[model samples]
Target chain A: MKQLTFDVAVIGGGPAGLAAALAAKEQGATRVLIIERNLELGGILQQCIHHGFGLHRFKQELTGPEYAQRFIDMVCRTDIEVMLETMVLEITNQKQIYAINQTQGMMQIDAKAIILAMGCRERTRGALRIPGTRPAGVFTAGAAQRFVNIDGYIPGKRAVILGSGDIGLIMARRFTLEGAEVKAVVEILPYAAGLTRNVVQCLDDYGIPLILQSTITCIHGKERIEGVTIAQVDQDWNPIAGTERDISCDTLLLSVGLIPENELSSQVGIQLDPVTNGPAVDSNLMTSIPGIFACGNVLHVHDLVDFVSQEAETAGCAAAAWASEKQYSSTRIIASTGKPGPCCPTSDSIPFDGVANECCATWGSTQIIIKPGNNIRYVVPQRICPDKKTTLYLRVRKPDQDVSINVGELKRMKHTFIRPSEMIKINLTPELLARHQSDYLDIHVVKEMVHHD
Target chain B: MIKTVICTVCPLSCEVELTISATNEIEKIMHNRCPRGKSYATTEHIAPRRTLTTTVHIEGAIHSMLPVRTYEPIPKELLHQVMQETANINVTSPIKMGDIIVRDILGTGVNLIATRSM
Candidate 1:
């Protein structure tokens, strides 16, 4: 086995990893390495050939490959090391990394700081628990996307897509353009799980019917997919018996949801937030394990890749600071204690076990706990250091118009509308955070009512 | 007559309702949050356009295929013809990003450019 050492090691080499590695290098981290399992530096972005990316970061519409190429070009100009076609086997809390590649055989990397950017995986049909025999044509929307976009192979002639995610919506249009018949896109939620732009451009423009509050209850066929049984669900999501109908199609695409990839984080004992299913991070995006930080989808599922890069840059700069032995007072305060703290009181209480609390002992520089209150789904960076400004990304439980996102009487931002499908970002400045008297900052959403005259 | 069109310019996806005159000119636009949404709804109500993104066959490259997209949004009705024209194209390696694979695609003045370098 060969041994190597670096100041920072980034896993995945996707959008998040690319941004993190570049930021770390720019932040004076002399030795930075990015380990990617794919043959190229771009991860899932390679297969995502559609445009509408980089709108926020670049202020222009770009395809996934185009967005990733910009970062890849920047990385190539720097001295950051990249290992393509390398699979990371294990990662320890001590910042030790184990990985393997065809040429290097077994390799071990000792790093001063590690960044988790493994990204997220698409939820499969098996996880949905749809009753049916094993079939060959059933595929996740992402797999089909890779097949058609990258591999140039159409999955089938006819298709019925479940879960109106962005991928599923895009695939519906792609299949139509490829001359494949897309019957309908069935979504379990009342509203689409994808961005409104996708639902309009991909589905509405193509004249594809989007059936809401419906789900595929059964997958029919033995060897190959023959058809599926789609039924409308009530408020409880239980299928209405008489509403069951069979749609004849050779292919069934599942785009249910995405779960953050965190096996490596869990292996190293990084505490995860039950709501986000990612590591519990502080304001600097550092995980509970001191030098280890996480960002992007591995930190939480982000609606846009632009935000992922922004968050990763935070993690990268923090990791670089740690590797360079920078004595930031805020870091010292947060890193002093590793024990879990108390959960903030909320009306809709989340289980105490689900919250990973880290209390700090340092004075003058106060540590604040961010709790998701009523109607707020989850907020990233559950802990915060009030010494600096920080952005909190969150989602609401349902759709509402004229809502106010309040952060513990310190700050409030108004929005025309809020939805679970779209993440809401609120920036808390140092002055606003310093004004709060309580150690626990409760973030909640309140729907404003308008009276008709 | 009134027609509702969802603006795809951004994630806001404002559902704009267009009130048209008897001659099909847009009389009023409602529910649009921004000027882009208003213009997007106007164009969509009149003539829909979409940017085409797909892969073309490539040889002597690191990968068997190269992802490409139109330089600008073309008429939505012409997407099928554009895809058909792209399907017959085969390019060689050393292609650079933004390099034109097919110029003036389908006479719409929109060129299909390579989205990535191979």
Candidate 2:
């Protein structure tokens, strides 16, 4: 068995892993390596041929490949080693990585720190439990994207999209441009799950109808997709009687949602968050197991790639500091401030002056757990240290106007509107943290009452 | 006449209302949160444009198609016509990012550039 050693070992070389490895190197970590399971380095970005990425970080509207190329090129220019076409078989809490490739048969890599950036996978038809025949035309929106954009084969001449997420809306236009007719984009929710810009540019501009509060009830096909039975649903989401209609189409694409790939994380007994389906982490992005960190879609499904990169950089910097034994044993403080568009932004620099081992020992005893309350769905970085600034990323359970978000008794902020599809960022400053007397922060959202004359 | 437009500047999605006169002039705008929203609604109502992004046929590359986009937004109505013109482009690989595939496509004065190298 050939054994290799690195200061930081990154798993899955997607947008997350790429940014993680680069940040690790730039943070003065020696011997940083990226382990990619795919034959190429770009990952899913290769098939994402649409524009409107990189609006943040780079402040430019770049296509997915172009956004990925910026990091790939930077990684190439550095000493960051890359292992393509290699799959990680197992990972141990002791920081031992067991992986295999055609060239290197059963190799074991030892790392001082490990960063998980495996990303997420699209929800399939089977997950939706759509009662239908196992047909060839049924595919996820991402799979259809790969076939049309990368593989150069349009999935079908006429297609029906089952969700109104960002991917579904993009594919509606893609199918239309490829000389195909998109019958309709049926969404079970009353509002679109994607961004407003996408809804306007992808569907409205194409003259494609987005039917809300309706869902696909059944499939009418044996070998190929013949059509789908659609029905309007009630507030309880159950199909309304006599509201069923059928639309004939050759393809059906499910753009339901995404789930973080956490098989390896759970295999090592890392604590998982039931809401995010990812490892529960603290301010340093470190999982339950010390010296092991998680970021990107593997941490939580992100709406944009720029935020994934920003988050991976945080995990990378933390892993590097952990590998070099530069920070407090298990209580490294990461300071973040302000609101991110849809994700939390890790601060550029936080002076660690006087962060002694003795100082950090008492900080862990002062750690506070963040609890989701009221209309709050979940908040990331489930725990926070009171001595430093921590940016909390959270989502609401429903849509409302004049919403007031409160973080225990320490802080409160008001927003004009808050929706389930959008994540809210709130920064916990040191000033606000000092007022926290409770052992846990119960963060909740409440709609303010309106007054009339 | 009054028309309402959804501002796509950000996720807020403010509904901007525009008052138009008989000769098709915007007389007044209301309900926009930011200056960008007013501009977005004005352009959307009068002369709308969209950045054209699509794939073209390529030979001797890792893939059979190359992703390309107009360097700037082209006229909204000219999108389908311009897409038809780009279909005639037959280029070889060994191209780099920002490489131009078609110059002034369909006389829109917007060049079609490659999104990434094959």
Best by DockQ: 1
CAPRI tier for the interface of model 1: high
Candidate 1 residue runs with Cα over 4 Å from true position: A328-365, A451-453
The TM-score leader among the candidates is: 1
**Model 2 chain A poorest ten-residue lDDT run:** A335-344
lDDT of 2: 0.84
Name the lDDT value of residue A250 in candidate 2.
98
Candidate 1: give the clashing pairs.
A341-A357
Q: What is the interface RMSD of candidate 2, in Å?
A: 1.6
Residues A1-453 of candidate 2: C-alpha lDDT, one tens digit per residue: 989999999999999999999999999998999999987787788778888778777876788888888889999999999999999999998899999999988989999899999989999988889986777899999999988888788989999999988899999989998889999999999998887778888899898999999999999888898999999999999989899999999999889999999999999988788789988877768787777889988998878787788788888988888898645343444312111122222322122111221222323434566778999988888776667677788888888888799999877788877878777878878788888776567999877776645
lDDT of 1 by residue, A1-453 (tens): 899999999998999999999999999999999999999988888889999999889998999999999999999999999999999999987789999999999999999889999999999977889998788999999999999987879999999999998899999988998899999999989999999989888888789999999999888888899999999999999999999999999999999999999999999988888899998877778887778899999999998999999999999987898788553455565556543334332213343232333323321244677888999989988878787668888999899888788988977788888889999888888888778877688999887776746
**Residue A285 error, candidate 1, Å:** 0.6
TM-score of chain A of 1: 0.94
TM-score of each: 0.95, 0.91
